[model samples]
Target: MPKRILMDHDGAIDDLLSQLLVLTMPDAELIGVTVTPADCYIEPALESTYKLLQLMGKEEIPLGRGDYYGINAFPSEWRARPEIINALPMLINLPKSPDPYAYPSAPELIIDRLSAAKEKVTVLMTGPCSNLVLALEKAPELKGKIDEIVWMAGAFRTTGNVQTYQHDGSAEWNVFWDPVSSQKLVSYELPLTLIPLDVTNHVPVTKQFLSTLATQIDYKLSNLTGQLWALTLDTIPSYHYTYFMWDILATSYLAMPDYFTTELVKANVSTRPPNAGQTYLDDQGYVVKIATDVNTGYFYDYLLSQFKQ
Candidate 1:
């Protein structure tokens, strides 16, 4: 039987790319797509996710909207991006309709599906871990049912996306967005695999790949990815046409584990405000397998082949 996978993302370009990768693979069954709050608000993120699923021809897969904002937090500047603002209403207005899939809540749906499945379900998270944390809180019994959680967050032994003014780039966005939840999750005694920025930064989508894919996958997901890729390039200036395949790499690990180098070590999350989003590796008595490096050439080639197909 194909592996059953539940993916949660924040509708960033990389997340969309990652979903596409999972949809194209024959060995994995994408059970659902949950929209978490990060990089964009939950409303628009849900809309984008709906559109992407339509493009992939998987409208039957259930769609769940997660927390609009982090637990015990307010909206931030990151959620106010023009692109995000414009995408909000598109959720309700998307032309292609979704199946009549319904669930009481994201957490409830997660537990229900996992409980029903005979095989262990893999939970792939690529955004702030608010939904999973809530699921664990509400239904503690479901913890044992989970197979493994493949996460794309944090910066281990490297500079983070959110740097302190005092010359230390220690904090990353996803964990920083919800420090309380991050700290809570790290304590869970489950099989966890972290694909941090250290590995993702090495695998970037090049101009050649993007240009080729734009013409191949003629769908809304591809168009949105192309637009976001263009915007990311404009901001960086140097590598204007390429983007770090952050979330894509995490999903790739699920579909094809042979494409990366992994290390087993103890990992923990920092709870203090000053040290939030910090992932400590080799911590005493805590063993976790974290990905440190990736095979970029193989990843790029595989991605290109997927789009070509």
Candidate 2:
């Protein structure tokens, strides 16, 4: 039986890759997709998600949107760029029309589906924990309905990939964007698993990997994927580093769990200043699975082959 999965993202290359991978995976019944802001701001993230789902002809899958501080869009007063993009920051950009989104918000949609689902629903989180955190807090019943949440967050036993001063270079991009929510979400001790930076940092993308993947994928999606990355890399030079296989590694924990080794750690995100968004070992908190090592070569090979299928 195919796993019923819900994916919430902040719009990055790996987020897109993970989306396409799910769309293509026969074993994945993608129940819905929820968009937040980590890569692009809220509007573009929502826009590109709807567009991608349309392109794949999977419009039946729900796409959720919301308006939260930073989660809705970048903090307006921040000095740096207002948004980032793997598709957005390029595709006509985030428009202000109708607030550009779908109904009931992400958490509502996710809980609604989980409430109705006959089987456990797994949420692949490629962004902050705002959506799940809200769902958990608002609808206490959802905790029993969900299977484990496979998340692409945090950094354990390794240096995070952040470089910006706003993040204090101590945090990973996703967690730092909304640390308080992340910290709170993990505290619930819901069935959760994390594929943190310690493992994902090894799943890097390059021209060679794309070339190989394109050769194996459907011509149209291959072309679209290539063009998407081209547009992103052209606009953001720094993304070359940020644009690694962060989310896919998280998906691996769901689709091919054996490829990655994880640890159940009592960890939490530091919501405070210079260390905000940085993940730390917290023996005092609930234990969540944190991926520590991976079969890197197998992961890449499997993804390439899966695209071909």
Candidate 3:
């Protein structure tokens, strides 16, 4: 039986790539998709998501949005970067598709899906935790309907990639962008698995990998992925060893968990300014499974073979 999945994301290039990964999998039934305004304005994020669904011929899947903003201790620092706004940072080319139908509020859609699915739904989070937080707020009992939350969040035991807060340098982009929601969601004693920067940073996107992925992207929907991969790889300076395809690492773990090692620990998100979104161990925290190490070789091997050849 196919695993029923409901995905929530903030529109970004890597987020799109993560969606494509699930689309390529035969045993994963994408129940729905919800977009958050974390990376860009909700309008652009919606359009990008609709376009991808149309392009991939998955237009029938329900769409939803997480509307209420999470508290960002530092709003100015939380704004989207140029690369993130453009989505495809290095290229001006963007494919077009028909406009999508109106989507319901994410919380409502989530509750409806939870009530309908016979099997507990696997909620995939490639962005901030806003959508899940809202749904849980609206229907706290829905937690029991969820199988697990596979999230690409937190920095954990490593240095963060972005400095959303002050000079603390302790937050990953997803958690930093919306610290309040992150903290709220993580504190819950729900079933959750976190793929933090500690493991993702270890497996970087290299030229050779992109080249191989290029050969597998013959479908029209995947052409944009191929182009973005090519352009991003081309734009990298010679000195760079690998580019971190952040969200995909979490999605990769979803597709293959045997390639990962995890630790069950209690952690919390810092909601204070100059230290927002810093995930750290605290007595007042939630205990969840967090990936600490990865088998990069097997992960790369599995991911490479998954490209539609």
Q: What C-alpha lDDT, on a 0 to 100 scale, does residue 260 get in candidate 2? A: 73
How many residue pairs clash in all the candidates, one count each? 2, 0, 0
After superposition, the stretches of candidate 1 with alpha carbons farther than 4 Å from their true spots are 71-104, 164-168, 212-228, 235-243
Model 2 Cα shift for residue 116 (angstroms): 1.3
lDDT winner? 3
- What would the TM-score be for candidate 1 when compared with the true structure? 0.84
Across 101-213, the per-residue lDDT of candidate 1 in tens digits comes to: 44345666676777777888999988878888888898888888788999898788787776443324576667777877877787785788888888988977678767876
Please identify which of the two predictions, 1 or 3, would achieve the higher TM-score against the true structure.
Answer: 3
Q: Lowest summed-lDDT stretch of 10 residues in model 1?
A: 234-243
Give the per-residue lDDT of model 3 (tens digit) for 39-125: 655666666676666656787788887676765532332233324434552223455423434568887888888888899899999
| Candidate 2 error regions (>4 Å) | 71-99, 232-242
Evaluate all candidate structures by whole-model CA lDDT and list the values in order: 0.71, 0.72, 0.75
Worst 10 residues of 3 by lDDT: 73-82
